[model samples]
Target: MQRGLSRSSSLPATSELGDALRACRGAFLGVGLMSCMINLLYLTGSFFMLEVYDRVLPSRSVPTLIGLIILAGGLYIAQGVLDLLRGRILVRIGTSLDEAMSARVFQTVVRLPLQSGGRGEGVLPLRDLDNIRSFLSGAGPSALFDLPWLPLYLAICFAFHAMLGLTALVGAVLLVLLTVLTEFMTRSPARQASGLAAQRSELAIASRRNAEVVVAMGMAGRLTRRWAGANASYLAGNQRTSDVAGGLGAVAKVMRMMLQSAVLGVGAYLVIHQEATAGIIIAGSILSARALAPVDLAIANWKGFVAARQSWHRLNGLLRAMPAPTSPMQLQNPSQKLAVENLSVAPPGEPRVTVSEISFVLQAGQGLGIIGPSGSGKSSLLRALVGVWRPVRGHVRLDAAALDQWSSDDLGRHIGYLPQDVELFAGSIAQNICRFDPEAKSDGVIAAARQAGVHELIVTMRDGYDTEIGEHGGVLSAGQAQRIALARALYGDPFLIVLDEPNSNLDTEGDEALTRAVRVARARGAIVIVVAHRPIGIEGVDMLLVLKDGRMQAFGPKETVLAQVLQRPAAAPIKIVSDGGVSKP
Candidate 1:
């Protein structure tokens, strides 16, 4: 019953990173203006030297010398103030960027696993955002901003003498060439190193998380070797990048020093020829060095620059691939009726469908049990129903409105879902049960825990509902985690409840509690769907949907479908000998 999707003519969208950058355009402009003022004030030292040597010393006027010193001190103070303001502005810009993009990046990270079928990683986006922020507030970007003033410094040198200006210009061009060469040599290896580093970090984190398994299985040595291999590759790539950049940096430093000396020598010649004064000679040397300083600083910080650039590209790509956020519609809460039409789902990054042409309808005050053998798509169907996974074709609607049409926050309020593998965040029992709602009522949280039959268990704990659950609820046992997760799903008495193997970790009492919880949910007129494998698991369900090999094998009232399946002829038996040989009968 599934249908193919239709193609649309819309072009791809831009990234939130771009939007954030545009929003900060005003701040950047202010920073640029600050840079202009700072660079202008940078002339204070050279001019002070010129005034002292050219005017005060010749006139032997102590008052003039003192006044010049005071003026120079005031200019220096102004330069310091401007520098401080520019630094503060950059910090603000970085903070603003984070404020704008952090929430969106976090949302994308959470959604990526579903969109890409569990193939996406979350840490990289967060890491990229941090990298961008650090670079903005670091010295690298300031170096770039100051780079534009290099030509102005050269012009000041030219005003001193043509030879001095030529020396400064040649030196600037040489340093610029070195910077370009540094980029060309290190670009590929730097990129490779960054990718390898991320892989190493991921592996290390995984190993730490599964340390018990590694220790119990005596896999420490093997895993260590694997990590070492990846680490070595990363180190090699990093060393290659560093070697090239370092070599160029050394050459640039030497060339800058030689340029300063050459400027001094040329200025001295001009002074001897009576074309320039002693003050002009010193001033020319200072301006020439200033002209080349930004280039040298840029070369020295090339690694940071490359890393930030790569991070920017990655974040931009991730944001671009993400769907734009839609304004939340003022839609009313959906009624408990649920419908699935020709639904099909495929695993992420794979073309083969896992579940196909699934169609069903369930109204309020009814419960359905999905029974299937291993690999029968039962869990996949439940996931699709609850909006955890997107269907390849067709629609899942609640009260005739498509699930995608509802805002997630609004839909979440009306839907409750518990997966087979349960997880609880690090918080108190009450917080987890109440879905961490800041405004959750105490009575409501207690009611949910009571409905799940874990209220007695909570009372026995040292702090009752206020007891903290450690990371992933590691402080609690398997049964405790499962029951707590059930309480979380039953919170607020949601209209649509989907549970996948809710009693998988429960004992006899727990199982009874689960049955009662389902009955209670049905009594409240909720649409309940349970995925199960055992007969007892489906005891209270009114309808049955049996799946086999991704197709619907049977669907109807539980007794009718059960009777039909039971009456069908069973498969022929095979005769087996004591030697383990089997004969078809």
Candidate 2:
């Protein structure tokens, strides 16, 4: 609810995600141990095959066969349990990481736009966190962990026969190369796909927000084609990644199968030459296949690995660039004055200052109105005052303390802001007025509603104060939404109430209510600033400022400033209307 923004100090340093990851080293080590046990146990099947052929069959002992079956079953069961435990542990690791970082990630999401103007990435940081968590929890990590055991499997195959060992070693090398190939092929396309997806998401959000405009103007077809173009670009990049991964995965699988067959053939030739026992044939094949399995799985998951890596890099950059805020010492609400000193302003995300070298001071119980031609920086100044846009230079102080000295929550409590565009969240009418405060009082909601002149209108609705205002208050008329927004600005009788074009959408009665609201706010010893589009909107203010082409042209008592600008006598009343015309005396 704090409407003000100031980058008055360096952002606090942050490396929390990295620290959280490093903290998980111990848990990852535990998973490594489980993997070790699981991989060693994988040899159970190969050795059992060896025993069946060379020991049990050769001796023709039924007891030995029964004993071998019992032993292999127990080992297999143990391996399965360890695997299950490892999977559970991995899942918990992902969840733990999410729990540690999601809040901070969301904080960055909210602050990033304010700091960077806007990169149009839109919630991508949250999506990046999700992508990383998914990669960790999925089969990718297991494949990576088991990849180191390939040499162990190869060594066992070597003990069976030299030819079998060579075949397995060659297969391992080939599979590793395929894995590398997959990495190289997919990285660039994955990056492209990610960007295109973000662009597509931005387009969808804009379309939804301006649905009325699009539908009203017969822009539906044009918008659809635009969306389709973006979708096609994203699809192209994503499809390229999938094709490369799938192709490489298929090749890896075929290579592993062929290697197993080749090892078996070598084993047969050795036995025919009396260089090896018949048992080594099947045993070597099984071991050789297991040796390369991890590499194959790695290749299959390379796409996710690349995507997660890119997402990881993006998050790190964003986090470091816009670190979490360090809350300042809490301060009491300003009840005395609002002071502006040498204030210079610009729109967020733009570099050039739109309003320059302006200074003003208003004691409590004073109301000031700013009048200007379009593009003269009236709105820009309003944005800076409410902390929506930080000033390039100078400071806005309340109670002689600079705005940035107040923490967002503390500042929000004392400040009320109504932008030219009235944005109301989906909720009951009372909730919107109260800014969704959890402990909002029923009486306070009504008080604000009445102050904005929307109270009588509210009682006529089906649910009165409880009436649902649907999405973005779509259920209300433009004037109704604007009035409700004013009620919101007046909620809790904020110490500094700022209204930008408050009467732009209001009828005559709504305008009277707004003028009264300004009067009441001043009566309560509050400082009120109104940016008026017409002279009538400034009627409640005793002082006025005129802006022209981003410069402060005049500032003084309301009638005096008006008369000076109009070249009329001080006693002559000059009224500036919305359409660049003044009323004659």
Candidate 3:
């Protein structure tokens, strides 16, 4: 939900489809030449078979006939071998295309305007990539090969008899039109079904991911209903698409049967009139069938072609929408003297600002605590400070420079942040701590771990610092995970530290230890900001700010706020709650 890399800039328009096909000149020429060779092989084999049928006279030479048979066999084998080689080449092309497209997609995502990133990360492109897979692998190349076959089959028919060939050619054209019409009828419905399926998958993924939360909240029945609804909608869309496509198929079948019947009747009349021979009739039938090959392929792959086109367009759109970053601000010393002037932030997916007109500052070697009730804008304030969500009205500055003016890399290098929920990769304990700076060495990693209060716990593990944690640090206890995340934040010696609910799940001892680490961060000249309703050992902070209903209720030194709390017995319990929530026996 944070303002990710700035999205102020756009990518070039021409970058959408990738470089033009002409730019890949060699690949296009290779594909075209290979297709021609394949068609030539097929035509040669067809003619060779036709010769055998024509020379059925009893006076034919046996040796010459056998030689012709051998020649035909060779052409068949050559065609098959070339096809095998071409298939391998197609695989390479498809893989290259996927890699190239994915690279562009990622680059565009990184470059896209920050506002569009969240919405753009949805399902269509991946589905489209799947479509691209089918196309580049077989469908696209087959369509290319069909281009040559259509003309060749027509030419062969013309050679036998101009009128008969013309009739077949007209039928071929009609078949193409029918195929296209059928595809058009199904295209919208198929796209709708595909979109519904994508949404269902996203729901399923989100549900699976929050399995623990669902179980804890006992929302199993609700989740099941939601999933069922998505699936039902998806199935309904799919059925509609299938029905339309099926109807088109039925129509095409009737047309094909009627056309073939007419062709046979015409051939019979020509033969009786002594205008054509039996062999010519048979050859014409074969040509007609050959001409239908591409038509059939096109009809069969309608869904795939539509999916691929949509995927291409979606990916192109995302890439084109990526935003460019602004120029980096010049910070002479780059120390953290964080300040917020009339800060405001609206929660994601909602229009209302949760924290409005809130302002505070934290200088080097100082710490500030933000305390508030649930939904009282405590977390929103930290998010604003960290540059996650931009304020609707005000501004945030670090060392007198606007947050927007800093480069993303520079901001990341200087500011360390830990969200309420921590995420860790699958790696050794040391690796997770030194995520960005891998060359930090064992000593540097261990020192940071010590500062975060996890060094001793790590040594107790079988692998010591080398212990491998599962996904998102699943192997560690919650407290251990928190400390490890703290170590990650402390790894690069950042200038400012933003901790969101760091002590929410920690026990009393863990809370005290975390507080000590925050103090250590302050000693390192970091401007430390802690957001928590329950302070958990923040008594020694330089300042305390209370937020309620999106406005600052109190802001000043801890003593002054503590005195205000004591004056009102109703609010006086905050100190005890702030001190690690310890209960009296």
Model 2 lDDT per residue over 2-55, tens place: 000001112223356667666777788899999999999999999999999999
The ten-residue window of minimal lDDT in model 1 covers 1-10
Winner on lDDT between 1 and 2 is 2
Leading candidate by TM-score: 1
Q: List the candidate numbers ranked by TM-score, top first.
A: 1, 2, 3
lDDT (10s digit) by residue, model 3, range 407-429: 77678778889888888888888
Whole-model lDDT per candidate: 0.84, 0.86, 0.71
Let me know the TM-score candidate 1 reaches against the reference structure.
0.93
When summed lDDT is taken over every stretch of 10 residues in candidate 2, the lowest stretch is 1-10
What TM-score does candidate 2 get on C-alpha atoms? 0.92
Model 3's TM-score against the true structure: 0.84
Clashes of 3: 11
Candidate with more favorable, higher TM-score: 2 or 3: 2
Estimate the lDDT of model 1: 0.84
- Give candidate 1 regions above 4 Å deviation: 1-14, 572-585
Ranking by lDDT: 2, 1, 3
